[model samples]
Each structure stands twice: as C-alpha cells, then as structure tokens.
Target: MVVGELGSGRAGSTESPPPDSAAAVLAGLDEQQRTAAAAVTGPVCILAGAGTGKTRTITHRIAYGVHTGVYTPEQVLAVTFTARAAGELRGRLSALGVGGVQARTFHAAAMRQLRYFAPRVLGGPMPELVENKLRVVAGAATRNRLTTDRASLRDLASEIEWAKTTLATPEDYPARAKAAARETPFEPAAVAAVYASYEQAKSRDGSLDFEDLLLVTAYALEEHRDVAREVRGQYRHFVVDEYQDVNPLQQRLLDAWLGGRAELCVVGDPNQTIYSFTGADPDHLLGFADRYPDAEVVKLERDYRSTPEVVGLANRIIGMAPRRRGLPGLRLLGQRAGGPEPRFLEHPDEPTEAAAVAAACRALVDGGLPAAEIAVLFRINAQSQVYESALADAGVPYVLKGGERFFERPEVREAVLLLRGAAAGRDDGALVPTVRDVLASVGWVEHRPPPGGAARDRWQSLSALVDLAVDLVAEQPTLDLAGFVTHLAERANAQHAPTVQGVTLASMHAAKGLEWDAVFVVGLVDGVLPIAQSLNRPDAVEEERRLLYVAVTRAREQLTLSWSLSRQPGGRRSRPRSRFLTGIAPESTAARRTPAARAAVVLDGAAGQLFEALRSWRTEAATAASVPAYVVLGDATLQAIAETRPRTLTELAALPGIGARKLAAYGEDVLATVAADT
Candidate 1:
C-alpha cells in the first residue's frame, strides 16, 4: 500500500514518505506523490498542473487502495480515456504489485458488463457492435437515397450518439435537435426518423454501435434494480482518468456501478476537456466537490515535467479565463524554475515552418534530448503531413497518427468486412462492401507499390488471398459476409497491428495523457489554436485554452512553441504570434526591449498608464509600425515601462531582455517617441 509523505519544498531527496500500512503501497514515489497516493478514501481531487506526476498519482493510488485493504483487487474499476492509457495504467498497476483490477476504456468496460448480462437481462444473444459507424451511416444514407458526404455521415452518427447519451429517444429527438448549440445537416424530424430507422435496422441485423454499448447497459441497470445492485456489489471502488471528458452516459454508468457504496477517486485536469463537441463535459470534473460535499480536494501543485518558463506562460494564458461565478479550486500556480524559454518562432510559411520545426527537433535530440522524448503537435490531423515530410527528409524517425493514410488501409478494412459479411447476412446491402473488401484485402487486384520490393511482395500475397476469398464468396451467394470478415479480421488482427519506426506525430487532441521529454507545439495562431470554430463560444474558447494547456503540459523538459506567417510561403501578410503569448508580457531581455530599470522614480496607477502609452509608442516607432491601441501593449510590457521609463536609447539598450537586434531596429524611434510623449 502507498504511504503519505508530507510537503517539504526542497527539490528531490528532501522528504521521506510515511510508513505504509498493509493496505497501502507507496514505492517509486517522491514525498508528494506518496501523499496523494495515500489520501484515497474520500473524494480526492488531485489538481495536478503540467509536469506533475498525474499518471503516477493515479497508478499509485490504486496500489495504495489495494495494499491498505480499502479496496479489494476485484472490487476496483479504473477507466481511462483511450485504450492506450488503459493499457499503460494496467501495466503501472501491475508494476506496483497490484493485479486483477478492472481497467479499460469507458466503452470497453460498459460493453463487457452489458454483454456479460445480456442473456439473463435481455433474454437473447448479445448484439454485434458495428465498429465502423461512418460506413454504417454511409450505407444507411445510400439505402435512403440521400445525397450525403462523408462529413454529413459523420455528423449523423455524432448526432445519434449525442442523443443516445442524453437518454433521448427518437420521439424526443426533434426538440433536442432544435435546442442544440450546433446544428446538424438533417432537420430534427428527419434525423429522428433516421435514428429510429437505424435502430430498427441494427435490431433486425443483430448489430450495435459504440453508443449502444453504454446506453443499453445504462438502461438495463436503470430498468432492473437487482442488476444495478449486483453490479454495485461487485465493483465497489471506482476511479476514472480524464474525468473531465466524461459524458452524461458515462456518469450514469458510474452512478449505477457505484450504487453509493464505493468511494470514488477521479483524476482529471478540467482545462483539458476538448471533447465537448462529442458531448463530453468538464463540468463533472469541476463540480466534483459539490457532487460530494465531504470530498477532500488535494491540489497537486508541484510540476516535475516542464520548466518554470513553460509553466509560467501556461498560467498567464489561463489567467485570462473568466472564473466561473462561484467555482472554487480553479487557479494556476507555477512550480518549476529553470528551463528553456517557451519559443515563439515565426516562419515564412508552412514548408519553412515544418522544416524549421524538424531542424529544431533534430537539434534538441543532438543536444541530448531523446527523439522518443520529443513530440510535434498541431491543431488538426491534416497538419501532420508537412512535419512528416520534413522530418523524413531530415532522416529523423517519426510516427504519424491517424493511420498511414486512410485510403492505404482499404485492404485491411476489406478483410474485416468480409468476415463481418457472414454474420450480417447477404440481404444487408451493408454486407456487400465487406465481401468486396475481402477480395481486395487478399489481392483480388494490383495495388500501387510501396517503396521497396519487400513491401511489394507482402501486398501481392495479400492481394492474391483476397482474390481467392472473392471467388469463394461468388460460389456461395448466400455466404454471410459479416462472419467471413470477422474470421479474416481475427486471423489478421494480430499480424497487421500498426507500428511507427520514427518520430511520433499526432494531433494535439490525440497527445493527451501521453508525455515526452521535449515537445514542439506548432501552428499556434489565432485562427488555428483558438480554432476559428471555437472562438465565439466561451466554453469552446476555454476548451481551446485547455488544449493548449494539454500541449504545453506534454513537454516534460524542453518545450518549443512556433507559428508561421501564412499557409503558403509569401502568399499572405505576416501574422503575429498567438495572443496567448501576450499573456507572458515583457519576454526576457534577449527577445524584447523594455526600459524599466533605469528610472529613479516610481509611477502610480495613472502615471503607470501614461508611461505605458509612451513606451508602447516607442515600441511602435521602433517596430516602424503604427502605435496600436493600449490593449495591444500587454500588461507585462506596460508594467516594465512604468518601472523603467527610459529617457534615452542607451538606457533602453542597457535594460534587461533588450537585445542588440531589437535596439538597432527600434531603439532610436522608440526613444524619440517616448521622449516626445513625456
């Protein structure tokens, strides 16, 4: 079992952990980590900022609970945001000598329980899960003869998932659709019709979608008190990771599972809730204290991951977020002291930006950081391409997320579909693609060759096998495409697991809960980072900030933040750095020129305001640009000017953070402007 270690501000080696009980295990943790681990009985909210050992706390918490006998090995249920996180948590638990605990993605956990009780509760066999919702939507749309693009199909699926989670039936969907913040392509009535039809089709074909896994289970528990009691009896301790991203349906599942008997320990950074569009809410994470008034809130403020520079910048940006009217426990406190300044490099355009990022990554590694320690993050999946090309050209190893390319995986998907065909039956037109995919998967046709002859040979063999499957399917017209596809998938799944041989490339959204030694946050522009779509909604804007917060936190040691002037080289005007950077105000002397140290006199509030205006004018003249509004001059720079109102250019140059490049470029103009204003 984990033991508690009280706070001692000394860095490493300063504090010793408390002695462990039979129920608590606290090995491999420093003082603070041990404290967090031991405090598991009450609702403990670990407000772990960036670089803090959040994952460690969660893993050790589980170990402590088991060791202390607060929770039995079989009684704990741990949920993570992704399958990868779930796996990592399970490994960590085992490493701590705790095993046989329940750990899985939220969907996986719900699906397991639902299927286990299907025979007794539903009085029938378990329903098949349609792994690919996009395809299902497309086929359904085709059947309805509705002209819809892939985006529309995805929208329909999302709408259905949202409705299902909200416990809205087809009869209740129209009003909900109209009241939703974001509109879908189909009208509310038509969407309700489509949802009803989709359910009917799935029921007839014995299929279930991802949402159904949670919804069906929630309904079963709510409808049958005995089952709910049984589940609560079995899993008495509940822990959820990325708790901020929990949707309503997930909360219901947890509520039913806990049955008020289990104590809850949920760890999540509310600022990292970026899945609101998918019905996830940060409110649940933020409102934990209110949900359980007796809960003990633990603020894990020591950040062991990022340097002071990165953490400082993150805190400043977050400070701009409006505090919820009555919400407590929402604040930023920086911990680390020494590290590289969070860079804000500007490039000519995307290619140059990509090349610069790749070069910087290489430099970081050569400078002693591991390639594995570095991650290149962007706003969207599409942004991974340039980095991949630039990094590959630089002979750097990198992994690309979102798959090698969707079109390139046709063979694998086809093979799975063929197996699925057997179970789905031939009458389901949806099963046709499965058979065709199988034909393509085993080599019914020639594919565009990959670079080497070795890859070519593998593709050819797979193609030939697919051709055989197609011919066999043709011979037996009534063959079930679904079942055949499933068989093929099971056989190939193990062999075809994807791998990356180089640098890891993924969207910012995909990088959460994972950490690296060095991280490059690219494309930090106004329209991109705040994301043009998220700008208007205060909640979305907060989520965007959380996304940036997530990206910054990912950098364990070295963090590089960069942006470009335009999408295409020299096509658009030079864009400024993200406004979030302004929060840092008066960057160190190396990158900025501020005159605050030379003054023999101090300025009051009104005087400070005037001094700032004069300094801003000086900056404007030195930049050889129009002196914009007072708002453009950040609080830091303004404060610096108030502290050091330089009467001369020489004094300005002598000031901290003012570099020669800045002096020569803007010195005379700034000095003259400030002098004239005074």
Candidate 2:
C-alpha cells in the first residue's frame, strides 16, 4: 500500500479568505485529496490513478493557495496536455471563485510567451504558425526533386514531428531513428534532408509550425535571463496535469518556466502513459520525487469514475506488466457500487463483431441509456469504418472523434466565410445569386471526384454543404444573405462537428480524458490490440498494454471487450484473443459468442422488401449524385418510410433526417418508389 500525508482539519490562519469564504474549498475532498490540495507551499508530485479526482484536487489547491494568501491567482500557472483539459481546469477554477490563474496547454502557454517576447528577443514578431505542415513538406520535397507518394509524404511528416519534439536535429535523425527502432518508409537521411528543406521553406514563408512554438520558447528562456525572470516573476506557482505524456521539449519549457524554483506540483499516472510514439517520456513523472527531494508525494487510489467490476478488470490487466523502479503499481479501489461484469465477446469475422457491437449499443440506448452516454473505441482510425456502417445500418446516430468538424472543414469554412462576406453588401432578393457566386469562388461545381479515396470524401463533404445552403434558402424564403450568414455563423459556433447527441465512435487514443457510461472496446485480437508492428519490441508491447488499460478505464458502468477470430466470413480462426486477457480473472468476466454464419432477420416481410427497394433506389441516387447513400436518406429514415408507407410527399418529408431540400430533391422519387411497391 502507498502512503502520503493527510490534510489537517484546521484551516490555516495565514491563508487569505477565498471568494467562497463561507465554505472551505477543501470541504468535500477525501483525506488524501484535501492534503494534496492544501500542500500549496512546496514541490509536490501526485500519482493520480484512473478516475481519481486529480483535476478537482489541483483546481482546489490553486483556490486554497489564493484563499490563504500563499499565492495570488495571477501568480499561478496550470498547464495540461490538451485544450479541452485546460479549458476544464480554467472552468473549475472559475467555479471555485479563483480567477486570473493561467491554465493552458504547453503549446498555448509557450505561444503566448513567444508572442510577448519575440519582438524583444528575436527582433521581430513571432512567425505565423503553419497549419498544414504536410503540404509544406510536400512542396519542399517537390523542390528538392524527391519523388514520394502521398502516404510516404505523410509518414515523413510524422517523422519530422517526432524528431523535433525529441529535440533531435537533422543530423541526429538517423541515429535517433535507429535507437527508436522505427521502420521508416524512406531513408532517414533522405527524410532528414526533406525536413531541412521544410524548415528553410518555413523561414522563407515567415512562419513556424506547431513544434517550433515550444522549441523557440525554450531557447528564448534559456538565452535571455531578463525574459525568464519576467515570466518567473509573473507566475510563481506551476501545476502540470498528465505529466506522463510530456515530451522532452515540453519538459525543458516547464523547467525554464520554473527556473529552479520548487513551487511546482505535477500529477500523472505512469501506467497510463501511451504516447511513446510521439516522443513522450513517462520517466519524468516516475522520477519526480528524485528531482525534488523535499517534495511531498501523494497517491490517490480511490477511483471515482468506474464501477467495482470495471476497476477490478483494469487493476488485473495493469498488474500483469513488469514493475519499474519509483513507479509503484496502483490497486485501485472503486468508490462506486458494482455493476454488470465486463463482457468478453468473440465473433467469427470483423463484420460480425461490428454487427454485435451495433446491436449491443442499440439495446443499451433502448434500455434508457442516452446514445451520447455510450461509445465504441477501437485500436485505430481504420477500424471505425465498419462500425460506422453498422451503426448507420441500425439507425443509430454517432459522432466520430478526431474527424474534422463540419464547420471546421476547409471547404465548409470557405463557403461559410464567402456567404458571410457576400451578406455584408447583398439584399434578401440577391441571396441566391450571392450563394451561387460564393460556390463558384470556392470552386464547388456539381462534378464529383472519381469514385474512391480522400478526394471522394472531400467532394462528398462539399456536396453536403451545398445541400445545406439549398435547404436554408428553401426554409426561409425571406431571409437575406446577412440573415443567413448570421444564422450560419451561430449554428457553426454552436454545433461543433459530430453533434454530441449521438453514439461516440473514436480511436482509443482520442478517447483519453473522456468517460462513457457504456464502452465497447472492439478489435481486441492479438495482432490488432498489440498491433503487429509492436509485437516484436517489448517496450512497444508495454505501450500497447497501456493503451488497452486506457481503453478499459474509460467505462463508468457497462464494459465490453470484443475480438474477431478471422478477418473474413467462413475463414478459419486465425487471430487469437489479446494476451492481456490471460491476466483477467475468468470468474469476473462474462463470455459471449457470435455464430459463424447468421442470416438477416426480417420482422415484417413486406416492410423489409420495401426497405430493400428504398435502399436500392438510394444507392442509385447516391451514385448518380456522387454523394454517400446516407446523404440521400439515412437507413433509419428509409426504414421509417417503409414501415409508415407514406403515400404523399408531405408524409415522406415528415420522416427524420428529411428536410425541405431533400423533400424537393427526392420527394417525387421516394413517393414513386413507395407507390410502385404498393
């Protein structure tokens, strides 16, 4: 068992009264949490286990320090790994009545510093940050006469990012690549040459990419004493969340920010570190105490997020890993009541596994769990394709995490901004003309990309945007360009891509820092979960284990792990269950098997026939229009239409996902199909 000092019940007299003086900020924290929060004076390292209230402890600590006069809110800096996490920290601090605390990701914080000191130190404004580095690198490769395909270019771009994050220069790439045991599609030296050319191009373009923000900021802080002193004077206290994922460049930045001061607190779980591919080192977190000998250490073992059964499975899985020095294993004690035992499911093929998952999700939603409260996490982005089709087939709405948001997409944003610009000078009657001109300006024609790949997806997205504009005009006949632009802006800002009202489909990596009431971990076969590339390397295997651990801990109530025995239907079972399953107690796990061959169940033969007819029509329409079939009509809407057998266009338009534009465009065809069937 791990040990740490507990919070003193007595409130410190020297502490200044916080905004909520009537109630102590430490009132609700557990003993360990309260102690961690109250330790506002010195270096502290918290081994915050999964589901532990790490965020609450740190936010309250900042509030308490402010309340007690130990540190002013302005003097505090809290850095996290993501923009979402930073926003949460800032919001929590505000709720706790502590203002002026700067909570940001390392990139955001460094950029801010760079912006402020660039004029003084670099003799000019900081360069504009490049948004698409791959495009720039591709351009550089072209200039350098290096022949490469799109996929290889993408891989080289990733290599460049890794090298920069690890503080490795062009000359250091070959050795570092060898050390990492990374297999490169191109020669390391060749990639390094492209990287050098990319840098020179950025300099010529007067801009910096994302990685340069941290690198330049670290350099300034080191070479300029006055700048470091100014930053240190402004923020005396530092707190970093998810310290386990901090790369070397970020660590160097943090050290420069602290300037050898001990007024820092870092919280992380070494077992949860899974970003090794991106150059993140958990050793900094594991050896935090050694760096600051006088630091107070705290371990939060009680998990507040997952149920007992879920926590037990997570603990068992992590226990199987080899132990490291200074990194004590956590035996998480679940604070919630027991729920259903985690289900271990096996299917004959990928499609069957996807179907079973979709069926389970539909059942859960039907049983009163909101679709938004559930998620299906897979090992990679590619696994999402079949699951997406399955969910759509089941008429379940879902949002794909890590996919570009509708409003944030380049074509969508361009079109909207054009509309916004045209609206400034155009009247209501001219809206259609303005929209047409905008579309023309954005190069959006009726033509579609030749059937597959990313170009096709982009064309589909653009077509959808045009359809949206058409719908807006049809709905509000009197609305002018300005009114429509205002409406579009409001909706764009209000609804970020992948509306939250649907089942979440995300990669396991993107699912970090999020929790769901029900989680489906799919594609848990040995080669997939451990990922064939990592199988030979022990360290890579360990990271894969951590990835699975992260996936398991994401569930708050229902948890399901699924694997496919074979890649194709009727094929021999080739892939085995992930080796991690061996560590889980058989008694605690429930098993389910899906049949090798199953036929589609048709409840009503007539409705099923009509659904099939509608799908066939939709496929033809989608193919002709060069859009996804779902764009024409969702499976659920088609099913509803078949069941209701809407006789009129009005009735057909009443189905979910059907709007004015769709009604105008497909209403006649849909009515004809239904009438012909009848």
What lDDT does the true structure give each of the candidates? Answer: 0.65, 0.78
Candidate 2, pairs of clashing residues: 15-68, 16-67, 16-68, 16-69
Question: lDDT per residue, candidate 2, 1-678, as tens digits?
Answer: 235501112222223454665248889999889888888887888889899998999998888888877786777789988766776787688777777778788888888889888898889987899999879989978877889888888988999999998999988998999999877867888888888899899989989998999989888889999888788888788999999999998998888888888898899998899999999988898888778777888888899999999999999899888997775667789999989888765555687677666766765676568887999999989999998888776556677788777778787787777777766755455566667667777665674333433444455556655555667779777767787677666556434232344688999999998899999999987888899999999989989999999999999999988777677766776677788887562321112322311212112457557877988899999999999887898654665566557776755554555689999999999999988899
Ten-residue stretch with the least lDDT total in model 1? 5-14
Error of 1 at 411 (Å): 13
Counted clashes in each candidate structure: 54, 4
Candidate 2 lDDT for residue 614: 87
Worst 10 residues of 2 by lDDT: 5-14
Tell me, by TM-score, which candidate is best.
2
Candidate 2 has an lDDT of 0.78
What is the TM-score of candidate 1? 0.69
TM-score of each: 0.69, 0.75
